[model samples]
Target: MLQAFESAAFAAWPAQQSLDLLGWHLRLDRGYTKRANSANATAQSLPLTASDVQAIENHFRRSGLTPTFRLTSFAPIEDSDRLLDACGYRACDESLVMTRSLAGFVDGSEIAFAPDAAAWLDAFAHASGKRGADQAVHLEILRRITAPCAWAVHASDGPSPACGLGVLVGDQLGLFDVATHRDHQRRGLARMLCGGLLGWGARRGAQTAFLQVVAANSPAIRLYESLGFEIAYRYWYRVPTT
Candidate 1:
């Protein structure tokens, strides 16, 4: 089931495009977030021999992207971590994949679906603190998702906006781009957005809600737990030192 989400999340947030190399899904989205650009090696069938590793690096290098791999608990290739370590790849950004059932949901009035990509981008940028290629890459990725999407914002009565979030890939309703405004921290806006989005998904016939949060983020993890979400699995990125 956890493995299913790793694939579902990838499907929901696809790269600008991707390639299948030796049963591995090599996602390419310029040089944006690791989640988008890194290859998912959970399904690798080959032994990840030295030549295979070098070829993977060369491919990403030529593609103008750093070689990266997203490693999960169920990766087929054993010793992937040792191989990555020997190759000067460091593990980073360990994150938890969480899920919750949608039984008693409350429709959130403070949250609304983004009318257009521009509006969605505005709130997304504010919460995530990303722009330029970093931001543009995600906008393109979001467009690739054909599922019913809800780009939500925490509407504030005052002038200052609180935060933003996105619920793409329905039924599963994978949550991504969750962020809080830089100026607004520890204000519970994220909690509001999360509740609102989950309820919003429930109304759309979504039965399960899933999201990825950095494991190091204690506050965020605590928040999710308080909301009845439990960790399903975890993943991390292996990136080249250079």
Candidate 2:
């Protein structure tokens, strides 16, 4: 199940460039989010060696980005983690992938749906307070998604205080980029928006919903738990010693 979600996530949050080498998926996206810029093991049986790790590092260096690896709990990468540790790689930004069944879920909020990718990007930027290059790259990623997607906002009549993204891969709905404006914190905007996205997915025949959140974000974790999501797996990034 984790592997299936891994594939869906790579598709849902695609990078600008992707290369498959030695049973690993290497991605690059202008040094943006780690998920889009890190090397990830594609299978459990990959025979990754220290030399392969060095080659991966050299590839990223040539691209002007730091070489990073996303190590998942389920992907036993032939002691690659040990090799990275030996090479002075530090682990950080551990995150949890939470999932829930959409069966019998209910959401009745009058949530607003963005008409297009650009509109959704605008709402997301406003809610997330992200501008300039972040928004530009995010828009490109959003536009690249070919799966059925939903871009939702808290309100339709005016500027949205909260926004979210949902990408439906087969029967699973992958939630991403859920954000609420700083001024609107503690008002349940995120909850409502997420509920709305889940409801949309359910209506579209989605059977499961999943989302990724930083493990250190206690408040967000609590909110996701309240929404019936449970930790399905954990993944973290390994960065070179600096």
Cα RMSD (Å) per model? 2.1, 1.5
In model 1, which residue pairs have backbone atoms overlapping below 3 Å? none
Query: Candidate 2 on 89-206: residue-level lDDT in tens?
Result: 9989999999999998789977888899999989888888988877777778889899999888887467888999999999999999999999989998899889889999999999
**CA error at residue 61 for candidate 1, angstroms:** 1.5
Deviation of model 1 at 13, angstroms = 0.9
Worst 10 residues of 1 by lDDT: 158-167
Instruction: State residue 57's C-alpha deviation in candidate 2, in Å.
Output: 1.5
Best by the lDDT measure? 2
**Local accuracy of candidate 1 as per-residue lDDT tens digits, 220-240:** 899889988998887888898
Candidate 2 deviant stretches above 4 angstroms: 45-47
The alpha-carbon deviation from the true structure for residue 24 of candidate 1, after best TM-score superposition, in angstroms, is 1.6
**What lDDT, from 0 to 1, does candidate 1 have?**
0.76
